[model samples]
Target: MWVVTGYAEVSTALTDRRLCKDSARLRAIIDRATAARLDGSRVAETVATDMLNSDPPEHTRLRKLVVKGFSARRIERLRPLVQQITDDLLDAMVARAADGTVDFVDAFAFPLPLTVICELLGIPRADQRSFRAWSTVIVGSSSRDDLRRTTTALGGYLAQMMSAKRSAPGDDLLSDLVEASDTDDRLSPLELVSMACLLLIAGHETTMNLLGSALLALLRHPDQFAKLRTRPELLDAAVEETLRYNSPAPVTTWRYAAEPMTIGGSPIATNDIVLLALGAANHDERFPDPDAFDIERQSTGHLSFGHGIHFCLGAALARMEAQVALGRLIERFPDIALAVPADELRWRPSTIMHGLAALPVRLGR
Candidate 1:
């Protein structure tokens, strides 16, 4: 296994066709490593069929079908809903801060995106909480039993949801996907459930981390926070900088070397599992004073959302959610400050995600 950390090398690895993402090839490697077939797990089998695990033609078809349902217009139309959700969460946060402190992650960061994504997917509000638990386990848990249990539950839930949509479709992404499944290039039942699971997990998990990390970044950099409060136009730039500085999805998923190739002069052999460190690449020497958190910096070309054919499909949605959520929080609480010392902050223990476990803050002066 090789970890590519240099900016140029990570960028190259992302676009290079030699780095394969095909699920069968990846499963073969995993099976070899574990000396057992992974097919015994039903949840694993269902989840493995997503676009993220496929190559060119298969990936292209899956992405095309999903893109139709997750259009730019669809995301843009949600701005009002995003704003409403942010405002409501802020109101709740303010109310809960009666003791002068509140866990922002619990009150705002987590629920805001969860609500939006659930609503977008046409998931009933009652079931949204279950997703939070399932997503947390799937992304953060180290226990295989726990992971299998949670995924099995989530897979079953999605199967039921898809069935409901089939009988009585709604004007939601899932229903759109159900309609797509009925077409000529239709998604198989496994693919349908897998795609929904991918969207459901990726949709909120990344954005939730983004919200928490962005606010944490601002709280640490008082000057930048103050500057954004006064110059609201920098909201977008602040979100971008936070992404580059503390990437929510810190590393790309595992990619296999289909053929021997050199990345930044280091030779990678066939079948080598490669992990591109997006967080490291974003902070590489390519960016002037990369360690410094400068909202005004030209933070373009960062691998925060990745590169090539696998760049985040939800980049626009994540950006919008962050911009709305962070912008509103800053606006509503002019004197918001960290409730504890900056050094006391703790991050979630996961290589795939960089996010705070909690963000306690004082909402008022």
Candidate 2:
């Protein structure tokens, strides 16, 4: 077995120029178990965006159009609303709980981010179930037939939503993107559709998993959960710690090295695949007792949001959403507990994301 666990090696590899995030990388990797069967066309069609695919200057221009709105300052302004959304979700969960037993994920974790994102995007409340189902198939499992169907249906719906935003602006990211496309970079209709597709899925699914994984970790380590509940101020740090501890999009993303670079003395060729193991990186010895979930740990160096110019554009929004969601969760259900055993829990077999199929949890005070 080959061993590779060091901050320097992983971070250096992630920021290197040798790796690339081209379509070929995903097509081959999506199915080591099934790839011998999928034709290149079928796989290439799944991911349609400049956000997760393509390098600068396409990435640079496309990212610039929306990055301004998601800056730390702007996201900070959105925090109170995030808090409200979190509170509302927890309220619903608490109302539904009977004898202290409730599916915390369905009750709280999943809905918090979904509701916030839908509100932010101005997606109609009535359409959430469809959006959730599509995102579930896209991120939860990677069956070729299922992914294609979800992608097409979801993409078409979001494209229409973007069209609506363009025709009649709203106080949401879609409107902002429409104006950005019209005035600033002149993004074509298809490009805008692709961007919407990226935001809708990436925005919702990642945060959903973040809450689930973080809550699971806390449940497994009840002492830490209590620490968070007792110290309200630790909420922000806890969010970052949870991100580093078990990032939602683990084992994927940041799949580029700009050119040939050497990592751990292993030569990676130009355009080679560079998979940053966020989970492994978080546990690297260089980070000091890496397994410990110390919310107080000055973890600004963490790569849960990634690094360099291509770092996740929505990092601030992600942080704000998770902080409010997790913070409110602990507030409403201080005695929250996992209703299922860890080993018995099923995980999404998607090659791109590391997330649970479902989180069975019960909430109480």
Candidate 3:
């Protein structure tokens, strides 16, 4: 295991040209162990649509295409949509909670990101269910068997959707990617499928967990929750704090050394699996007052969305969605409390991702 103790070291590891993280090479190692559980046929297989699966020129190309759909200007415009989704979910929670009890996951955490991504991607109403199921397996697959079946099925789904877009392009991210791909063949049929899957997994579910993690932390820290409730404008830092306190995907996508490299004074060998601990790096004491959830902590940068050229494309969208969702969730239901004890809420058992299994709560009497 590669140890990274400082922000500088992590940053260097990410941007360093010395390190290599070609997706296929790393996939071989990852699937080697998990292949028995995932289909044996896919044992050496890599995902078709993942950004983490590419290197250099391809990485830069795909990142730029994804960025086109998520520019700061575009994300700023998405604020109203984020707020609208927040309001709609809170309203539904109120309607469902006639007696003042609601599963916060259903009422808020799940729908907010789901709706926003569906709108952002311009997924047809009819195809939403397929996307949802595909997303769950792509991002939330419970077991290896589940991952394989879903991978094949979702690949087919994306291929079919791309064909539809080719005929009748809509005003969604897929269409944008298609148009961009027309000029640049970086997004081939396989890559197109991979990109679609990447969008849903990265663009949707992770944000759901981001909002959920933030809400869960606030509820557990009632004093902090109260402070945020009183000062609604502190949302940006609050969201960043939650990301630090409880990283959604605690371990980033696994990376292996392309060649022998030194990181944090350790000589990592070629093909060594290095799991970047986003949660640990965020809490490094090097970053003054690492644990105190200060709402004004000048949250300049964090690895919650990741680092380097392969940084998250949906980051701006994720930030907007979290700020709007958490800010309004508190504003609308100030008394939102966990139906179960904080200790009883189970965390997803996945080794890579971290999130709640369920988040039931009482909206209030």
Candidate 4:
């Protein structure tokens, strides 16, 4: 894998048409055995057919169809609801920490975003667990067999959900996606399932990391935490800084060279899979003391949500969720601190996602 870690190269790689996102084209360049392995699975094919896996005009069509549902106005309208969810989850965390300590990840970080995304997608509360389990496997699982099995199971569930939506539509994003039909163009059945999988998984998973990592960052930097505690107005800066300090996604999904070209002065090659390290790029020497976590730092030009067309669709929602959850938690428990040594905390085993496995803290009274 040709890894591009410099910010300039990563940014250029994102918008370069030469480095394509077409799944079929990418698969073809891989070893024939691996390509066959991926192609052999129906679940893989279905999930790979979505906007994230395609290049324009297919990507353009899929994006246009989905972007309407996540307009700025619609996302803004969700702020009150997101605040309510955050408050409720914090209330529960308070109760759970009657003993003065609790696993923050279990009580707050995971559930907050999970609940928001489920509600946004109109998924039943009871189904969130299954989806979570499936998503866990798809995102973090190392075993190929396990990944394939969970993806197949998740795809089956989405297929059923889409069928139900067709028979009886609702006022959710999925319904909007289901009912969306363009001028002689519409999302195919597999494409719909793929899109749902993408949204459902990406919606909560990325933000879950953002919340977890942001909290962890604050806890480690008490000075910055206290600064934000005093000036809640710095909440937005804190979020941006956290995104840059430890990008929720350490690396973006792989892109392949469609034709021979040079990157970072490297030799040209067709179909060379390039991995852009968002975390590394965010901390590149291009920025002054990039490793230091400073909310006051100007955090523009970071590749946290990526660059160009494939930038995260739910960036606004993710920001809102993190802002509300972090702001409320800190406000409610000013004395909160790590329950265990900082070094004891374990990060989730994910090369792509940078998140703690659990964040244990004391909710000082």
Indicate which candidate wins on lDDT: 1
Model 1 ranges off by over 4 Å? 35-40
State each model's CA lDDT, in order.
0.88, 0.72, 0.74, 0.86
On TM-score, the stronger of 2 and 3 is 3
Candidate 3 per-residue C-alpha lDDT over 246-345 given as tens digits, one digit per residue, 9 for 90 to 100: 8787766667787798887888987777767777888887668887776667666777777887677787788888887887777777888888788888
Backbone clashes in model 4, listed as residue pairs: none
| Tens digits of lDDT, candidate 4, 1-365 | 79999999999988988888888877777745253445445677766888988899999999988897778998888889889988898888878785789998888888878888888887888888887788777778468778888888999998898878778988889888888842234988888889999999889988999998988899999999999999999999999999999899989887888789999999758877889999999999888999899999999888999989999899989998898888888889988999999999898887778888898999987
Give the Å shift of residue 348 in candidate 2.
Answer: 2.3
Greater lDDT among 1 and 3 belongs to 1
- Per-prediction TM-score, please? 0.97, 0.88, 0.90, 0.96
lDDT of 4 at 150: 85
Cα displacement (Å) at residue 126, model 4: 1.3
Indicate the residue-level lDDT of 66 in model 4: 83
Deviation from native of the Cα of residue 13 in model 3, angstroms: 1.1
Model 2, 191-238: lDDT tens digits are 777777777778878787888888888888878778888898988888
Give the worst 10-residue stretch by lDDT in candidate 4.
31-40
Worst 10 residues of 1 by lDDT: 35-44
